[model samples]
Target: MTALHCDGSLTADRASYGGIIRDDNSVLGMELLAILRGVTLCIQKDLLRVSIRSYSKLAVDILNGIVSCPWSLQALKVRITSLMEQLQRKEIRHVWRELNQPADFVAAIDTGDGESFFYPPDFPLDLVELIKNDSDRKTYFRTPSH
Candidate 1:
């Protein structure tokens, strides 16, 4: 099962969820990502104790197609309305793919395998470590001068 985390959460208790839904349509990557965001947000809502206030952010690293494709664009808009209506405020932003390697890897596996694959939360320790190491390297290099 895939683990979903809430990026806007401050508590350690906020990140507990797992599930995989097969996508038979082989939807475009951006569209799939959009759907994942919506589903994850819905799950997040269930896990949280209180309502999420305005300005909560959901960052994603995806193609411009999310906004460029009419169908995908509309589908994504609908996801928020239908799935996230309970939340008072939220923001979704597209980040650089390099900053979101783990998520990219997960999506790639979903598409490349052509079949859904679920694993324990710690199943891919190596991959998770690689992402953590890359993030640390970037942080080190980007550290501000004294």
Candidate 2:
């Protein structure tokens, strides 16, 4: 249930990085819902790009349903509806597990039950290194920089 994010600009700089630890794990639907909720909190802008590792097909369907016709049990409708409205411009895609190892590592860390944490821009050295490697790996598709 941990969330990490960073934002910086030419004149000013900012970073929103944190992690949330749930008490325990559950089914795939609940897990996906929890992660989505965490991600919504981390967003700083109207547009967002997301990459997921588990339950790829299910995740895509859920997200698309939110944008198109959001329907869920009474208990979950509010959260899903809110997220749909909040996300004005977004792209959600499933990626290889190897590609998301860093995020998985962060989420897997034990931050204590119901505990949360935040880090500076350069914190989590291991995760940063993984990101660098993934960006450079040839098997990972990349478009030339403009």
What TM-score, computed on C-alpha atoms, does each candidate reach?
0.44, 0.54
lDDT of 2 at 98: 72
Q: Taking the tens digit of each residue's C-alpha lDDT, what string does model 2 give over 49-94?
A: 5433443445555555643322343345345546655654555566
lDDT of 1 at 97: 45
Q: Could you tell me which 10 consecutive residues in candidate 1 have the lowest summed lDDT?
A: 52-61
Q: What are the Cα lDDT values of the candidates? A: 0.47, 0.55
Best by TM-score: 2
RMSD of 2: 15.1
Error of 1 at 62 (Å): 12
Q: What is the lDDT of residue 31 in candidate 2?
A: 47
lDDT of 1 by residue, 38-83 (tens): 4565567574222322111222322222333335355654554455
**Candidate 2 TM-score versus the reference:** 0.54
Clashing residue pairs in candidate 1 are 1-119, 54-89
